[model samples]
Target chain A: MLKAIQNLGSSTTTTTRTTTGFVASFYRLKPPHATTTSAFVSISSSLLSYYSPRTRPTKPLLFLTRKTLSLEPVRAHSTRSESKMDDTSSSSSVAVQSSGSVRKINFCQWCGGQTKHDIPDGEEKMRAICTVCGKITYQNPKMVVGCLIEHDNKVLLCKRNIQPSFGLWTLPAGYLEIGESAAEGAIRETWEEAHAEVEVVSPFAHLDIPLIGQTYIIFLAKLRKPHFSPGPESLECQLFSLDDIPFDSLAFSSMAVTLKLYIEDVKAGSRKFHYGTINKRPGTSPSDTHGYTLVNHLQS
Target chain B: MLKAIQNLGSSTTTTTRTTTGFVASFYRLKPPHATTTSAFVSISSSLLSYYSPRTRPTKPLLFLTRKTLSLEPVRAHSTRSESKMDDTSSSSSVAVQSSGSVRKINFCQWCGGQTKHDIPDGEEKMRAICTVCGKITYQNPKMVVGCLIEHDNKVLLCKRNIQPSFGLWTLPAGYLEIGESAAEGAIRETWEEAHAEVEVVSPFAHLDIPLIGQTYIIFLAKLRKPHFSPGPESLECQLFSLDDIPFDSLAFSSMAVTLKLYIEDVKAGSRKFHYGTINKRPGTSPSDTHGYTLVNHLQS
Candidate 1:
């Protein structure tokens, strides 16, 4: 099994096997639905340790769960048993992320049809056009909604227990789900990561990270009370004042930007809605330093 | 071909044929990527006219494009030529829209593998689990970002040329895409629908409609110049003050809510950030009577 995993022809295939093993290894790692890159790195590290000769370069993404899953399985299986194994391990890898997949939508999830990247009659740009059914799959930006909860003039932060940036402080946020409003999604993320109930004050920040195709909607909220602990995604949930907030250790640039904005808002005594773009900082990974530079647009 | 179009086993299949005919009939209808139900209705009315004997009901959706593209054609073609066509026509119909497809991930887009809807060990709910690769797929909410441009106390409104509410008024908006910020998307929509350039002032509204799995992020902006015209998506572009606002002729609940809120904010002299949900009206088809009720959470 490990040999098969090791010999996985493409990185996409390797990642696929790594993810399936991680998913099948234990559900306690985190629900596969909300699996993070941190989980991938952790599981990948273990899987890599099992094989020394070939260390498949790990992708800094956990997009498997997003681009996978089929509603028509009999066809999926029949195709798999036929000639699809090579293609499935490869083609499905492009444009699959929580931040929303873009470009090279090569397969028709509807008809198992191969697609040609062509500009349909009136479109200015090329799209993955299914040869059989002529369907165009579009991947758009995903919203990461979260809360910057304040109680006693301090902000609530969760130390991430999972990968990409494990053991680092961050706001409680996740991809917005169906049947829930953005505010509802924010509240759910707070509860899931920090075990806290919060009353949203107003929209605090609308930070766009175009590089990764995500918009961070961070709400400024107040704790309902003082009651809190940690949920599955957190190692610890703590309240920190501006003086003590771990600016250097926040898991994401979005979190750091939100906290700094909160502090600035507090000091200025004038609360305004903040909207801006976050560009990656130079000479560093997205996790290094504060990780991003905030370029605010002129306020109305 | 007509019989095949008529006997398309599922409404999903019916819709698929209708869409293909519509798409193939003319790309001038609107680019399939940004297609709306108005196009569906226009085309379906023509399609339904052709087959009078069997009045297959038309769905009030244009979801075929978002769920139908495939990257692996060899597998897709192989699967479709076999038993997959019936399944594809039926299965690909669920959980797809501009507002984002949700529920029922049954086939692995990666492996053409069959999936079972199971609650993998620790999940709170059942998720589609791939029987072949053990991978899961998740669907989340989509965002409709637009601009609410105000100049001389009048807002720029576009008379929609597309369906569900053709000839009705609305703010210029569309699905947020992969490479831009919400504000940038709003700007692009404004240009596409109204042929106008505007400068964003601030994030205005983040309205959520859980029923449709969509969030609208509207920005308050001012037209850059006096220049304005109608784009393909609009029949006409006009500036309307609160008095002349066509509240009854608006296209969507989200547009109505945002306009009304703008009126309210003008009267109050406080342009506070609005965060709320717009639930469908009790007796309307989401297009009548301004189509929805706005329930705002207490402002922060």
Candidate 2:
């Protein structure tokens, strides 16, 4: 069901690794239609503009170009059964039951009665409605909360001990609980995953991954003390300087984007809170697959 | 099933009218345990501090105090059948199926099969599990998006044509769509409810009413032009200056608090975006019932 094609270049070639555990060759595909511009091409164009020859060296620039373009294919399958499999391969902590399996809500939880999938009155979409109780069940996006803890120019990271990216590094984050603020949830998750105590400064990023039906609210926090250890959910916990970040082994795309933004903002001497949405678009190639747009930019 | 107990004052008794058409007398009851603090008392205390005498005059203060406190009983019944009735009295546009009845989901919607009301595997809450297809049905909080549109020193207000608060004025807002950003949802709802085109300035308020399972995200916006008419959901649409706002006939509690905060900020000569949460607490008196807390205050 999965295949990797390598396009080798003379003297210098860039390879990117995906969650599928295969390295794919980096190549830009021309737009199939003349009038339509693909998101992949736009991203690449922007990346080329962002990493100009006057600003940075060539080696790291090539690495970043490959890394950003690699997100397309994984995001393309985000709404399909293949996407579920990709998610499982990347992070077993998600709530997907199985890959390539049909999900159907056949029973009503309120009365132990049969249900029918149909559109309810005054609603735009189809829902699981109970035949006996006349109650319509709604499924909303789940919220994931995490913190970007900065202590003496180092950011805290945790290595997963569980499936879905076993041994892969990630920021301390998890599903939000009921009856708690987003900031509170982020703080709690940080403590639970990395055993770190940190005070949240403000909301840093709000990314909506609609394909997976999850919204991530990340907060910028200050470490209370330099003390830290791995919690039950983590294999190891440690702080790393900006230069030592494992960009390739990161568990999620949102984390990578956030870290990159933070680094860029710090380098520019203007660090601010950012809120944006990440959406995956249908495209012909991996490079043209995903679109990340910043809707609101606020400085704190 | 309905009773109203009035504690008449000697000569000047205050009577409050509920959306249910009941004119209940306003009276304060001490907590059952004097030493123990209920959410209601805490809210009242905080409200007293928030509405200190130094900020404004005490004439309209009584009405503000009464309005904030009136949320207690409705919130108290939010988890019960009576709460549904209260909601029907206030706004009929909500997604609740029935009023004054126990809601149950008896049948499964996915496969038209029987369902069991039980906790699914690896979950903390009980859900409607499917009998045949084995899908767990999950219900989550709905997102309510709206805009606080300001133009020429006036804010837009819409009179609701639907039930639950028929004829009561409200800010243009509605349930958010699955695949749209919160700001986009707010803008769409504004157009749908008031026939107005607005450019969103920033997120102004985020109120979580877990009692009714809703999180409201209200944005501060500016009207593109002075063009507006009543939409299908609205009976009338008009702009109201700060002095002309109808606090007594507003549809929801959060709207009242947002307006109040806006006024207070304007008065303090610091007109900036505010992000906060409003929580309703169980109170003894209807006028001392709910609390609003500013968890994170940032000036932008």
Candidate 3:
């Protein structure tokens, strides 16, 4: 559900602002000025280390390797049929679709020319080929970057006021914006969701929810302070200790994995990078991760 | 340019293939059948360790913290204007464009409803909104996953027969497709560009080429075998020792950063994960990463 927690304003209270002559100009097509960045970013760690060349390297440690991660099978990972509620991003429609109904591309975004599904020269898959411009529309997975912040020995959780998971608890994470790094996206999501500041300690996990075409990059972080508030997308925000954490109502399988890993690391007193996948089971609420199988690369 | 090294068949030589009712049946709308994955994946490592409960955790190492990886201001990273030739992805037109001419969204890609740039209610940025369906189109950077393979004390490099960097040297990498993990994408790219299978040793570098809205995930890998040939996207695949690498003709600033990190680690006799940004100098060839400044998070 990451796409930066997507579409903040309620459609009912809506007012459409226009730009580019057809609409009143609320935003210039030029991106330099972000009209929506309300939260100021302040972090504790230096995500950008001003480069000074150094040669010393330490002893190499153990590294995990994956022999083959196949994509040709029935992808048993989809244990249940996906519900539309699971994906709320407007952009999610650009790619992967339900077998029952795929969003057909009838026109090209590049040239506005009528398009049809056809394999172009040398290509193997059917693409939305523009008859006029002869261009193809390509879609891929989106990256959701966020942080798992620890402050005062507690974890921050947002009760989503948003539709995707409605009232479930989730980490402050969203789509990684253009021209931004994973760390920047993580910090931004934290601010936008919880109205709290955080400094990224390290990237904790890069988990792929391939069924939904999303890659969640969660960073281990610390609150800049103990203060926080709920942003537009959240009904409320609260900090909870391990015992009080809502394991059952967690929003996404990715979130559950992250929190569990954090708790494991917390108990073992170790922190390391994890790469893996979550195979979601069918007929479960979007918030429920029970029965989901996790494939963690580091452990293997 | 890594959208799977983009369009493999030369347009002039491409034979328009079709599926569905309109075109020749080369593929099905359903994805289970990958009409194009020709190579068999053979890996030396286990990408997915089947999960098992474990109690003990390893020692936590020095974790680099990044205070703020900012996204405001002029974004000094673009020391020069980027050339369109650098991006060969058909989907590149979906988002991020030259200041002179941005791609206009005239219709909703979902419903083919005529669209115009407008700020939806509660949102600040002007999105291409479908007047009929009342939907929005959002775009984000793409993920490029590839690997740095060490085979017999030499590294693998592909001579691109494809554009954006034809004739230049590059590591085997391409766009991370939907329903694919970063490691799988890396291995797939290795097979596609070099016709060589590799086992991902570990995630080596994750660098964001934000200027182009790209995040490159490079893994340290060992080729499954010494045998390899150029795939469709490459003119020739070759192995080069560190001393013979074509430093100047290397394609993509991100590639430069990845290789440099690999070389540095090689000399130091240690392998570590790296994350950072590459500020590509303007007016320079896409392959020419000279004068570029690298801000490495881990090194910082």
Candidate 4:
């Protein structure tokens, strides 16, 4: 998709790195540094020119319009369902289930389903307590960053020092800082976790994993310097070839999908771009690593 | 631009309504829809495939990257000294100024410099609190929406419902809702303000009047149905011919820009999409009009 967009007669280019792959080409685009950027202004104005003739005073043309692109009613995805909570006027009720049990049980962890549990310990309980609002406030996920860095045809990998995956190898990624754009956050994470100066490439992968309460956007990037030392939060940071990727040691199932996608891009050659999971059929793997999961090969 | 994009081929039509002058007749391809959208996806993808095979896979394509897009810098019209407020943390200070004969000056609205008289009342102070983080918030200009609706070779427009031009003519446009997509909101505004069921023909106009705290995107739309009844908000909604556009009664200077753009698009026989101000040039109109406020163009 990056290649296709680039080939649209646009003079725009990435300034971050000099990678040839479309995914790796984002590094060449100049960073937004000054409050007023001359280069950005010029490109934007030129791109606008591409649309200028259309708005010029002349004969009007017939246009096609639709309420919906497709007649098919979209089935609700888990992420869509989760986002709905944010849209409601106020937080709404959500039934909590422990594990996979279907029993109707809503007792507080601090205090079981008893009247005493509702009483405050020292200060009087606030009369304006809304349980639904409380639940939503407690469960909102922070924005997280994920990246794939390349060096000498090998991809960089790191083992997270935190739990959920204390030892499994993963991409050099982390949460975003306040007031920073996603791309900037991704680069900052690459630096902090991998201790490497890397150029961010095109945004190639987006995965919304509702089960784990996370939305991961995996970017393809190029390492400015291949030599990187692991930061304190990383158990280790190292490069691995496609064949040598530690599939068994992968942390989240999403990482497997990310890797599988990178492999497909490698195989599809230059024109390989969008791998949108928007229309993935139901019952399919949320990660969509159908034939590529390590467990699948291990089981066979 | 859209016609050029649509009729990339088709040698038969030379300078027809659908023909963008610069496009190649050989590239014309019929769209699956009544209007051709073939170039939007397929042609671009095919173009990406034409990249030179020998091009290094690791080198960045400058045009495709953001760094190379040249956008203009914001020119400062004010002669005030360049001073930045360093208050990301928690300190507050007061600054006073004496203007000529007036010794008791007020607050500096642009820099958050407060004056003794600027001290806030409890409720007014509360109003300034940021809802997102519960802190005093800086003022920001609100966003507005605008639209161009076409019917019977004429375009639909509305008279201003508010000041600075209490009753000037302009396209039916307004502010965007919190979470609305730019295009979606533009369409919705047309329906609400004009009582017209219209299809968005092509996006071709924009205006960003930061001095007055406004940013707007104007779209050209095909009137889906001529039968429309003015909604409660609109004083009147009607069509105006190209030759009969009420130039003197046009709402804001930006509205004049949209009208001029629409006229140019008709002459150019295509859509001209743009960002920032509708006219690309700086100060195209000296002493531009500020208040032709078109409000609530789109509902969430």
Best by DockQ: 1
- Output the lDDT of residue A27, model 1: 14
Write the residue-wise lDDT of candidate 4 on B1-300 in tens digits.
Answer: 121211111112122121211100112222312322231212211111112233223222211111100112223221111101100111111111100001122222112233232212321111122122222212222335556777787988776454334455657665443222343445556666666656544445434432222345566566655666565445677788999998767655666666765686679775544332211122222113331222111100
Instruction: Please write out the lDDT profile of model 2 over residues B1-300, one tens digit for every residue.
Output: 011212211112233322211211111333323322433322222112112233232111111113123223222122111221114122211222211111234444455556665645433334455577665443434556788888898999998776545677778887654444565567767877887877666556555443344556677777765798998778999899999999878766667767876787668875544433344433322122122322233222
lDDT digits (tens) for residues B159-233 of candidate 3:
887656678888988777555567767776677678786666666777765555678887777766578899887
DockQ of 1: 0.16
Q: B177 in model 1: Cα distance from truth in Å? A: 0.6
TM-score of each: 0.67, 0.62, 0.68, 0.33
Order the candidates by lDDT, highest first — what do you get? 3, 1, 2, 4
The local distance difference test score of model 2 is 0.49
lDDT per residue as tens, model 1, A232-300: 768999988879999778776677667766776689886666676664432234355343455433232
Q: Which ten residues in a row are the worst by lDDT in model 2 chain B?
A: B1-10
Q: Which candidate is the best by TM-score?
A: 3
Q: Taking the candidates one at a time, how many backbone clashes does each contain?
A: 22, 26, 17, 69
**What C-alpha lDDT do the candidate models reach, one value each?**
0.53, 0.49, 0.54, 0.37
lDDT of model 1 at position A39: 22
CAPRI class assigned to model 3: incorrect
Q: List TM-score (chain A only) for every prediction.
A: 0.66, 0.64, 0.67, 0.48
The candidate that wins on lDDT is 3
- Per model, kept true contacts as a fraction are 0.35, 0.20, 0.34, 0.00
Model 2 docking grade: incorrect
Off by over 4 Å in 1: A1-95, A98-104, A298-300, B1-95, B98-104, B121-123, B298-300
What DockQ does each candidate score versus the true complex, computed on alpha carbons? 0.16, 0.12, 0.14, 0.02
